[model samples]
Target: MSFITINNIWQEYGDHVVLERLNLQIKEGEFCSMVGASGCGKSTFLRLLLGQEKPSRGTITLDGKRLVAEPDSHRGVVFQRYSVFPHLSVLDNVAIGLELPQSPLLGRLFGAKKRAAREQAAEMLKKVGLGHALDKYPAQLSGGMQQRLAIAQAFIMQPRVLLLDEPFGALDPGIRKEMHAL
Candidate 1:
């Protein structure tokens, strides 16, 4: 059996049909990519995988179980638009997702635990070429920097599946290639 399966999938909005009778199966450790023109259902399919959208008809299963309505920690996403926390610094923004799921209290980690989370967030930001902006808020960063910050935030969570929707759209080719390397 495949690790991820999409069976007889169809997505529609009112009178418009985006995807029709699509069937796909991906086994464990396999890599998959979808390519198509604009307005195609690639984004829709990704959204379905991310649990951001439900198929009009059919099922999408992961590891032999069906997907739930709400998105889970098992899946991570970096959207095309900016998804940073304007109120928080870059370090806090990146560490927040990782901190929340593991923390027993109301997303608060103190002392060494807090320090470790911040250190990890800083390292992730450095890897994504946003090290210098650690103290800055999301508003201070440029579009590409903001996108990189978002990527760092999502990647730090170490989710089972990472879904990126035009994640590098705002980055220059050189920086995009660098991100691909990381």
Candidate 2:
């Protein structure tokens, strides 16, 4: 079976049909790019794959299992707008997703797990070329840097599928090209 499958998918928003009988198959570890004119439902398709929206007509399957629930650990997303939390340091923002909820008292009293998560987050940030910005907040970084940080956050969890919605849309052309290369 295909790693990710969309069969006869349809989506409508009010009177508008954003996707009509759209079908797709994406293989695991394959890099695929979607290109089209505006209002072509590219972003909507991403939302559907991410389980943020339901198909009006068809089924989406991941590894042969019907996708009806949002599998938090299986998917990661990076949006065009900076999705990082403004108040947290870059390392914290990246680590937040990797941390699990412990018993409230234990979580409050323990710093070891938090430190481990931070260390992993720092490693991920370095992998995405943001190692130097670990201590900075979102507002302190440039647009390109912020986008890179977002990429790090999404990839830190090592999800099976990474959804990127026009990630380079807001960057200058040069930087956008650079990000595309990365």
Candidate with maximal TM-score: 1
RMSD of each: 1.4, 2.6
Give lDDT per model, in order.
Answer: 0.90, 0.82
lDDT of 2 by residue, 2-86 (tens): 8998899999878899999888898887888899998898988888888888888899998898885564678889976758889
lDDT of 1 by residue, 142-164 (tens): 99999999999888988778888
Where is model 2 poorest over a 10-residue stretch in terms of lDDT?
101-110
lDDT of 2 at 72: 66
> What residue pairs clash in candidate 1, if any at all?
none
Candidate 2, residue 120: lDDT: 88
TM-score of candidate 1 versus the correct structure, residues matched by position: 0.93
User: What local lDDT score does residue 164 receive in model 1, on the 0 to 100 scale?
Assistant: 83
Error of 2 at 78 (Å): 0.4
Model 1 backbone overlap count = 0
